[model samples]
Target: MTILRRLAAAAIVIGLGMTALGLAATADWRLGLIVNFRLQLLFGFMILVAIMIAVGDRRWLVPAVAGLAINAILVGPWFGFGLGTSSGESVTVLHLNLLAANRDTAAVVELLHETDADIAFLAEATASWRRRLRLVEIPFDVVATPGDVRFGIIALSRIPVETRVLGVSTFQLPTPLLSFDLDGEPITVMSFHTTSPVNTRRDAARDEQLMALSDLVSSVDGHGVLIGDLNATPWTPGMSLIEDAGYQNSLRSSGLQPSWPAGLGPFMIPIDHAFHSEGLEVIDRRTVASSGSDHLGVEIELAVKR
Candidate 1:
């Protein structure tokens, strides 16, 4: 056979290998850290599969197609290519993890104005940043949970805000649970920022936070919304808690809108997310242009199961 055919065959093997590793990650979090990286590599593996398919080798065609099919199954729905289905009335929500060290508060203000979301959440906010946000006025009432030397949580909403700090966070970050009264309807809103799972301690903290968030989701009696930077991808074992909690990802129908490390373009992982209970559904979802921060902002339109 030709050297090109050999290369195509080799590439197919690599793609399948990587896809397998990503699937393995779903089982648990012990390999969560490593498998998360492999999951990211799925993009490149799919590219290689495409290249081989384009090369037109009969032997490589089947493997290449299979690789593509796997991605199409696992990653396809994230791009919102799923069968178009309607849920409830649309209420827009914008969520972002504003870098605490970022000095460009003006960008946040502009993004808020640009998205014009019914509710907005800014995580990793500093006291000064909170003060700056006070300047720009939107239709929603504002709830700034600014405590000293912790992950500052802030929320802006048109609905009535009922702050509920469930229990103390193991990571000492702000409680993610917030309740809102919108047009006589009660919606539980949680602004969560799971601790970055960069290290063992932090990963443990992140796991704990997810557990707490899951419990909070299960405990809610009415419609609920969870918005924040979860740090873990949806496929990770850490996210299983959310799945077990009976919540759905807002972007599931819309597609995977990668939100972090903005300059990477399509290469960024989607750390920021909006998850809601069965009582709520995301009717429309979109990601905004990078708001001068590492993570891109996400705006989702939710429909309550009325």
Candidate 2:
């Protein structure tokens, strides 16, 4: 084989191993981090396969095709092509991780106003951030939990809302549940910020928080939406618990709206998410530009299922 073909074969072998390792994320938290990049892996394999095909390098075709298949299965569901739509009163919701230390209040506020979402959930919203937001003209009623500076949660709404702070989970983060009426229909919105799983302990804590959120969703009597920086991706292990709770990931139809590590562009992952109950369906969803945080905000329009 030529030097170029040899290099292609070596890369394909490594890429196939990485794809297999990502599938083991359910067995190890560190591997879970790798799994979040399944989209990148899939694209990398595709590019490699195309190059090999162009050069007529057939020797490594089998392993290259296998690598592509593995990554494709892990990343395909998010690009939900045949997901049906819904019709009824719709609400525009926005969820952004404010990156606690971000001081670009004007820019973030401007983004909020520009979106003009009916309901907004801001994660990592510190007391100072809330104070700064208050100084400016906030057109919506606001509720916030200022206990934890790193994960303080905020909910802003134009509709009348009944807000309550639920008990902290294993991660010691308080979850805010917002109850409101949408066109005379009662709807619940829960906003939470799970600890980022950078280590084994943190990963376990995040998993516990995810389970708690799932149980809470299951207990809701009617329609509900989950909005926050979950710190876990749709493909992560614990996410299955959320889906089992009967809430469909809004990103399913919207595809992979990578919202974290905002400046990285293609290197980013969709850790921030919005999931709605069976009674609701997504009408529109997209990621907002990085205003002042490491995470890009998500704006989704959901309507009552018809």
Best by lDDT: 2
lDDT assessment of candidate 2? 0.83
lDDT of each: 0.72, 0.83
Candidate 1 ranges with C-alpha deviation above 4 Å: 1-10, 26-46, 53-63, 76-90, 134-141
Clashes of each: 8, 0
TM-score of each predicted structure versus truth: 0.83, 0.94
Candidate 2 at residue 184, lDDT? 64
User: How big is the RMSD of model 1?
Assistant: 3.4
lDDT value, residue 212 of candidate 2: 90
lDDT per residue, candidate 1, 27-65, as tens digits?
A: 444556545544355565566666666776666777777
